[model samples]
Target: MYEFFRDLDRRWIFLMMFLCVAVPIIIIGATGKTFPEEPTQLVRAVFDEIENLPSGSKVLLSYDYDPASEGELAPMATMFAYHCAAKGHKMYFMALWPVGPQMVDDTIENIIKKDFKDLKYGEDYVNLGYKSGYEGVIKVIITDFTELYSTDTRGTPWSAIPMCHDVNSVQDMDLIVNVSAGYAGTKEWVQYAVTPYPKLRMVAGCTGVQAPLLYPYIPQQLHGLLGAIKGAAEYEALVIEAYGDKMARKDAGDNPLTDDNGDYLIPGKYTEGIRRMGPQLVAHLLMILLIIVGNVIYFVERRREGRR
Candidate 1:
């Protein structure tokens, strides 16, 4: 058994990894069971920041990420849009990355337009679209929104949009929530927007690698943060727990069915980040087990050679 284990084929290891990932994913897809997420301080802060805001507050959502990092950032973006819309906040969407506008559009389609049909385009939310210039755009919009943005993404003049008529600059926003991947992202916002405008309240959801870099700015430059998918998962759990009943009631109207606790039903998609965690946990465990097994085989083989 020891000899066979020491000489294990590479293909067998690949097969084990394949099973580790695929089995959990298939089980989760069918049963909808996900690993439970406990809200970390960072995630809790993000949830509270949005929750504490008054209804109809103005929020600026900067999508500074592209599809390349969408898998990590999109879940939080979806939750952000949903939470703001549910809380009756007026959302102003803009992107620093060229493909960022598409990300915003996808969120609107999936979360806003699909879930909250009553939200009017220019009234409840407005898409300012993507603009050129890396941090240069952030610098310009920090003080003068009109100088950089005279029209929405679709070519409609800002004069036609009701939301744009009242805004003068980024400072006019009550809160700024940014979902970003890398450069021209959270760092740019902290420098160009929050740094210059100290009063501006900002929360950000960024890739895992960027989280540590931004930690020093917490509670000062950044009000809250969601770091990578783990942060997204925790935040998603918090939002769902707080707002699930409200969503169920809204969707079902009068005489909606409730669970034992009287909370209404919510869609499965709301817990997507959590659901993905199941596969992640299983894959990680499998990797750890494989490492232990490999090390054991190495030591056993080394001992046998020494004895011979």
Candidate 2:
């Protein structure tokens, strides 16, 4: 066994790694099954901040990422919309990045339009659309929203939109939820909007690389934070466990259908983060195993050379 493994071609190792990742993804895609996730304190904080809010509370959802970071950012963004809509919060969607409006549109289409069809636009929610000037936009809107944003994305004036009628600035919002990739994102919101006002509450979802930098503001300027796909998966699990029909049925003393793996059936849209995590988890394990085996082989070879 040692001899064969010692002489194993690099191609074989590559093949094993490929199978490690590909097999899980294919199985998950086919089965609609995902591994369970235990949400951390940070993720739970994000969920709670939204969950605890009173229904009809105004929430500013600032999606500041473009398509380039969509895979990492979109899942949480979708969940943020789903959770807010589920709670009957009045969503105010806006963007800092030029492409952010499209991201906002995608979330609105996928989660709100598809799932919460009864929600009326302008009253239940409104798209304030993208504004240039990055943090400058934040600075202005924090004081007088109409100074920078006088209309919704559809060109309807703010005075015309029922939700905007009472909303004068970010200060009027019950909570601010930000999905960000870089500058003019969570950090800027914290520094400009939350810090000075101190009355304004905020939470954020950001890329893995940006998570650490924003951690210091948590439970203070930022109520909670979700970092990267893992954070998204954990938050998804919490949301699904809370609101998914299968879990509801199970709680109601009915038997809920489960997959062969005993995992509860979940909608494909809500499982993006979990499905993506499957390949990553398997590949990481494979890498770990390879490192251990290579170390064992190196030590064994050193012993043999010493004996000779």
Candidate 3:
């Protein structure tokens, strides 16, 4: 039995990990209980800022993710949009990645339009689409938004978009909410937008791998951060608690799951980060147990040889 267990193929371990992830996901989907997540200061700060904002405040959402991080970053993006819309904040949506515009469009379709349908385009919110210059665009926008994105996704001049008509520069925004994956993301936004302007408030959400790297800038250049899916889940919980109940009373018989807090349980949206944690925790335990057993086997063999 020892030898059989010792010779167990790695594929067996992989199967076990798969089951650990797959099973919980199935159960969670049926029952909305995601492993209890406690929102850290960073998560709470992000939610608090939006909640405290005066209605119709100008908020810029920089979608710096591509299809690669869409799974992790998209949830927060949707949540940020919902939070801003819920506050009646005028949203100025734009993206740094070429595909980012599509992501913004998808979130609007899924979370915004489905719920905040009454928000008139060019008034309550405007999608500035995407631009190509990376950090260079940020440098330009820090001074002027129109010179870079002269027109909206619909090709109407910036002047035509009532929500954005008065906003001439990034400084005009009440907050810069940056959702990023890798390069040309929060780092770039911090370097070009938030860093120079002492008053340019910013909050961001990045994948777990990128979180550590951005730590030094937090609570300074970045007012707050949402780290990976866990961060998203944490922030989502905060949103649900603060806004979900309020929305429930007003939305009257409306499906809370569709646009309200229920959007946090978004199918496949929260999967990557939340689902990943289960396997990661199991894999870590398996590796630790393997190490301890290996050490025992080595010491036992050494003692047996000495006895002989």
Per-candidate clashes, comma-separated = 0, 0, 0
Q: Can you tell me which runs of candidate 1 are displaced by over 4 Å?
A: 1-14, 249-264, 294-308
Query: lDDT score, residue 64, model 1?
Result: 92
| Per-residue lDDT of model 3, residues 1-308, tens digit only | 66655576888777866776677667656764455567898899999888888998999998989888887788788789888988999888899888999988998887678778899888888899999899999999899987889999999998877777688899999999999998899999999988899799999999889999999998889889999877887887777767755444233464444544445334444234454455445556767877787777778778889999
lDDT of 1 by residue, 117-179 (tens): 999999999999999998999899988898989999888888899977788899999999999
Task: Give residue 219's error in model 1 in angstroms.
Answer: 2.5
Predicted candidate 2 versus true structure: per-residue lDDT over 1-308, tens digit per residue: 99988998999999998999889989988876678799999999999999999999999999999999999999999999999999999999999999999999999898888878899999998999998999999999998999989888999988999888898889999999999999989999999999999999899999999999998997888989999999999999899878776322243456665667565666678878878899989988989999999999999999999999
lDDT over C-alpha atoms for residue 301 of model 1: 75
Candidate 1 colliding pairs: none
Candidate 3 clashing pairs? none
Q: How many angstroms is residue 250 displaced in model 3 relative to the true structure, after the best TM-score fit?
A: 9.4
The 10 consecutive residues of candidate 3 with the worst lDDT sum are 264-273
- Models 1 onward score TM values of 0.89, 0.85, 0.84
| Candidate with maximal lDDT | 2
Worst ten in a row by lDDT for model 1 = 248-257
